[model samples]
Target chain A: MLVVSLIAFVMFRFVGDPVDQMVGLETTLEERAKLREQLGLNDPLPVQFWNFVSKAAQGDLGISYQFKRPVAVLLSERLPATLELSFVSALFALLAGIPMGVYTALRRESFLSKLFLTVSLIGISLPTFLIGILLIFIFSVNLQWLPSFGRGQVVDLGWWTTGFLTVSGLKALILPSITLGLFQMTLIMRLVRSEMLEVLRTDYIKFARARGLKDRAIHFGHALKNTLIPVITITGLQLGSIIAFAIITETVFQWPGMGLLFLQAVQNVDIPIMSAYLLLIAFLFVAINLIVDLLYVVVDPRIRIGGAEA
Target chain B: MSDALLSVRDLVVEFPTRKGILTAVDSVSFDIGRGEVLGVVGESGAGKSMTGSAIIGLIEPPGHIAGGSIELAGERIDNLPLEAMRKVRGKRIGMVFQDPLTSLNPLYTIAEQLIETIRTHLKLSERDARERAIGLLDEVGIPAASRRIDDYPHQFSGGMRQRVVIALALCAEPELVIADEPTTALDVSVQSQIIDVLKNMCAEHGSSVMLITHDMGVIAEAADRVAVMYAGRLAEIGPVRDVIQDARHPYTKGLMGSIPTLMHDSDRLTQIPGSMPRLTDIPPGCAFSPRCPKAFDRCFSVQPACERHEDREVACLLYDEGGRP
Candidate 1:
């Protein structure tokens, strides 16, 4: 979370001077000074940072130069789209990867396990960009599903119901979801297989076997619990990584998410929008880390990471 | 009613190593009577624990029982496959391991783990299982048994965890209990406490025990009969008193002589002199001939067969020669 706040600070700086960009590119010197003074840009850097932070605390991220709306309002409106994509990705990763990984590990040296392991290795090695393009080709161009890109708002739901929040939104989600899921599932599968293999080697697991725990209970009850800590840790770390790649994914799918918004902010050098986006991303990274830390405590009671539990 | 509670004959366990087939346990055999305690004593790699694990079907990967027969209550257990073998582990045969810290699964509460063991084998309601858990916890001598039941494995001290393991093992009232160095990891004082609990419980329940360990003191104290293994072979098997006081086999004598006894002025307390040779490096003759002090040319050249006496079995050429080492 501290990293998140600091990213918010750094985001403000990434767009160059806000005052110069706020006014016209050809504004006169005296006009620039007046504009700067009005916007509090004339204050020292630290003071300006203080104002930015305090205003951000009150939910005002100033105004976007291009949109002319509060940055927070813009982000708040668009934030859920990225969250939806990430959620779909994370869920699919676990559902797809865990079983295959477990099967591979348990099978050990079998031909089928080798095949699955090989595929998983290939999956992990491939870049997310390559996967995104391949997915776009297979699902979008070849199959012609939902016209290739962009967040689609709802036009008709037969009743005055949730608009842009219904099937239309879900339809907009598939391409990005597959892209994120493919990347994360590959990594998670590898981790799960390796960790399960290790857990299955433990003396306690041997004891469980000796206790005549059915293979199912031994795998799920004993081995899985021991293996989940690593997968969770990897999941937490991978969230930041997933967010990083979402920039490319959001760009590819043309989804109207924070990634796309941040892309525009970077390309246009729009100070408020860029700063707000960077800060939010940074905050998300740090904040998710904190949550994962707390979750570590939840999953495995033995850990007291950062004295949080104590 | 003449059925032996546990019988193992010609048990052979081998591991494929980089060099060759390393025989970890070679034709080692014994039996336990109903309500008897059989102690298997050996050095670090003498296959004592391997024998215990093979009986419980806990021998892991890379080490396979090349050839063996294990009988529990007159039934051929070794002929049974994995699924059938699993039924014997906790239901018919129980195990308590060396380290109390590592033996119990760490994730669950003591109550949860104990109840899991009960419900897995026994047809009992949740309330009945809970009642049984509380009773077993008290039987294992834990203070505040009802309250501490909710605590995790780490919450208990080493001795307490061993007691919990003992409680778990005997909860099903298994006909055979294989305890592998159950108290070796505890403090010296706690060791006797754990052993006392085990002895008292086994005595009360009339369950046969295959106590696999290296501690001569433990073997002398608890085992009714003792089987001394050397380098994966049983060097001697006899009643505990005979085995400890008047060991007939040279390897058994070497092991017995190696233990410390106070009030005796001796050089280095009768050390075994050399380490047990590696599995791959066993001499062609008797496996222990490399380390045996009484090795003649015959003892070093050709392996001697096991000779049977009234209530003892000695595997040495000296027995064949009609001479005692």
Candidate 2:
């Protein structure tokens, strides 16, 4: 957490002087000194870092210069939106990707396998932003299937077709989620297929066949379990990238999320708000990676790395 | 007894390589009776392993049975579909592989894998399967079977893992077992322990075994009959005592001579002169002639026919004596 916080501080610090950001280069030296003194830029580096750290620990991330409010308030308000987008996209990716990968790996020479591999290759190779735009064009302008901009209002249940929590909301989320999930899904699928192929090459698979195990039992039962180590590691690394990608995805879709808030802070130069938000996202990514690493050890006990111990 | 419990007749297996079709097992044949062990011995690529794989219907891709008939207990098994083969496989035909280290799935606990094997083959409930697994584990000499069954493959030593594999194979009490180098991947002492377990277990269960290995010592100790493969063909098949005491094929004699024996102490170790040819370069007339010390003009020029004695078969010119053309 400290390292992550330092990253936020250093990222802002290296981007150049906060006083220059605040007072501008055209100001007189006396005026700049007055502004620097007012902004507390005269404080030592260690004191500034400590001040931010202590306040952040207390859940009071100081105040944003541009937004003129506590950084925590903006983050809390937008947290749900970012989470919702990430959840939706991750659901699409896992739901489609794992099975598609398993299928391609199992049926390597078949036409279905070839088709899936080709599609996954294409999905993995292209940029997510390009795919996102293509999807927006197709669904919004060309097809006119749903609203192109803006969002559905959050309301109570019974509005099945057209409320924030209803089919309209679901439809609204679908395009952006799929566009965001495409590359990740493809990447995961490719990872699974390759790992599954490696697992199949092991001697146990040959033994399974000699034992007269059914194809499903042999493929899913014997082969799949062994391949899980690499698959799970890939899943952990990809999940970190997922959180990062969700930020960009939310920005592109103009969703009312932490990502949008971060973008606004970046544009308006809301130092505390942007820095705090970035550190929080980094914290989430680290937490997620830790969770996945532990989950892998739980699933397959054989995996033991540099162990502070699970 | 039962006209042989498992009979492999004129088995021919071939694989299509990039260059051409290379025959792996050519006109090789053998059988195992109830409560019998037939050891198939040869150097690597002699098709001993391929024949074992083919009999179990586990011939991998690009390699397949070209011509053969496999009869298990009077029923033709060559045409059985994959589902039927599966039903036969853990249920009626068990297999123990060479590598004890990798034979069991490392992720799942031994109990889980064993229970799955038991339940899939037998019409047993989960509780029954669990009980049966413990029983099988205990039978294989795994101490504290109940507690240790939950441990993953890594937790067990190599011998213990191999024992676990044996227990898995015996879970269904199949009619026949194809133990392909069952003790190959164990320490020297552990090898003897495992071989002893297999011998005693099969004796009690009335399960025949087709044991494949190149170690003459294992064959001498465990097998009632021995089949020797040279290149892709069976060079000799006979009762163990006869084959070892009076091996008919020059290749078999070379192999027997090659075994470190106190009785036949040569100045240097008696080795077959040449290396076994690659499958693609197998000679037309006789694959072993180039290496055999007793090779004559007839041996090099024409393929020797497989001839049968009372309970032995030999495919060599020496066996025919004056009968060769």
Candidate 3:
């Protein structure tokens, strides 16, 4: 987290000037110098980085250059939108991906299996922004069944506002979440299909058949259980990527999420928000990886023994 | 034949490839009487394992039983539907694979696997199934069967896992157990112990065994009758003593010669002249004619049908009624 914060601080520190973005043209040179001094811009690089790190540790992300508000407060307000979208997307990917993967693997030559494969291929190849626009055009422009932009109507509950309580808020989440989740769904499906295919050919599966296990038992109980070991790791890592890269989906839909805030921060040279986003993303990646490692022990006994030994 | 618990006739297993159809097991026949141990001895690719797989209806797709009739306890099983065949598989005839390391599902506890198999074939409650699983594990010589029943396959040693496999195969008290090279993957020290466990457990369950292996020593020790295969065909079969002491077919004679005997002071063990013929290039007449030391004109021109000899059956022209005419 510290390294991520440091890199984000160093890289964004050079992009335009926070002072220039914050000041007016009528301001005199003495006033500008006084403003820089007040903002502690005259401090050495190490001292500036140290201040950023120490303040971040204490949950104070300094202040946004553009909003002139606390970065943490801005993030907390926007965090729910991105998180809700990502959670729904992840749930869709896993719930749909695993069964589709198993079906494609088991009945690979069937017509429906071929269709799923083709659609998944398209899902993987198409970019998120293009998908988002296409969905918006179809659902919002032509059908007018769903709203195209903005988080519809959010409900505030003890500082954690959610669109879930409001019908419009739920409807508004549909397109952006699908656009963001399609690639991951396809990825997970393809991964599960390959893994299930390999597991089916293993000796244990053959032995399971010899033991007269029902197809359902052998396929899901034995094969799918084994396939999930690797899938869990990939899904966890993809979840981290989903939150960090929701920027394009958020942009196309104009959802009031952190991705939109970060984009605006980037345009206005808001270094504090930029650094905070990076640090948060890096922290999420590390935390998700830790969870993935824990899941390994739960799914595979061989790993449980290894973990115990370690 | 009437006493035979399982009988296979003219069984042919074939795999069709882009090149052509490859006959994995061609017109093979054998029988395992109730409570009998029939050892199938052959080199790799001799269709010994394929024959067992065909009997259990577990041949992989595109490779299937092309022409065959299998009967268990006087009922025809070769024509059974897939679901019916599945019921026959673990209920009437159980199978033990070669590599115990890869045979059991590594993710499940032994108790889970055993109980599942037990409940699938028999109408047992969960508590009854667990008790049966533990009992079978104990019968297969797994010490601390009750305590170790919950352990996953990986937690057990290779030999111990084979013992668990045996326990699983016999949990429903199958009438026949087709153990394909059950001891092949174990250490030499563990091999005999595993064979002993398999034999004792089968005996106690009153289940016949079709033990397939290339090791003649294993056959000599475990089998009541022995069937020697050469290139997907049964070359000879009889009581283990007669076949080992006086092998009738030249291929069987060659196979017996290759066994390392402590009594023989020969400098080198006798090896068959060539490897078993591949499925694509089997000779027109006898598959072993090219390697047979006693091949005559008829042996090259016509395939020999199995003929009854003094005490056993031999598939060679030399054993014909006219005696090599």
For every candidate in turn, the CA RMSD to the true structure comes to: 2.9, 3.2, 1.3
Model 3 segments beyond 4 Å from truth?
Answer: B323-325
Model 2 spans > 4 angstroms off: A14-35, A155-164, A303-310, B264-266
Give, for candidate 3 chain B, the lowest lDDT window spanning 10 residues: B316-325
lDDT for each residue of candidate 3 in B21-118, tens digit (9 for 90 to 100):
99999898888899999999988999999999988989898998899799999999888998999999888899999999999999999999999999
lDDT of 2 at A193: 88
**CA lDDT, candidate 2, residue B72:** 96
Tell me the tens digit of each residue's lDDT in model 1 across A1-310: 4455556667666547777667777889998889778888777877877888888778788888878788888887777777767777888888988988898889888998888778877777887768778888987788887545876664443432222476766777777777877868988888899999999988778877777778998898889888998898888888876775688888888877788888898787777777777677777777788998888878764564325546
> Predictions ranked by TM-score, top down?
3, 1, 2
Model no. 1, DockQ = 0.70
Report the candidate with higher DockQ, 1 versus 2: 1
The Cα error of candidate 3 at residue A142, in Å, is 1.5
**Pairs clashing within candidate 1:** A4-A282, A4-A283, A8-A279, A11-A275
Candidates 1 and 3, the one with greater lDDT: 3
lDDT for residue A39 in candidate 1, whole number 0-100: 81
List fnat per candidate, in order.
Answer: 0.61, 0.61, 0.81
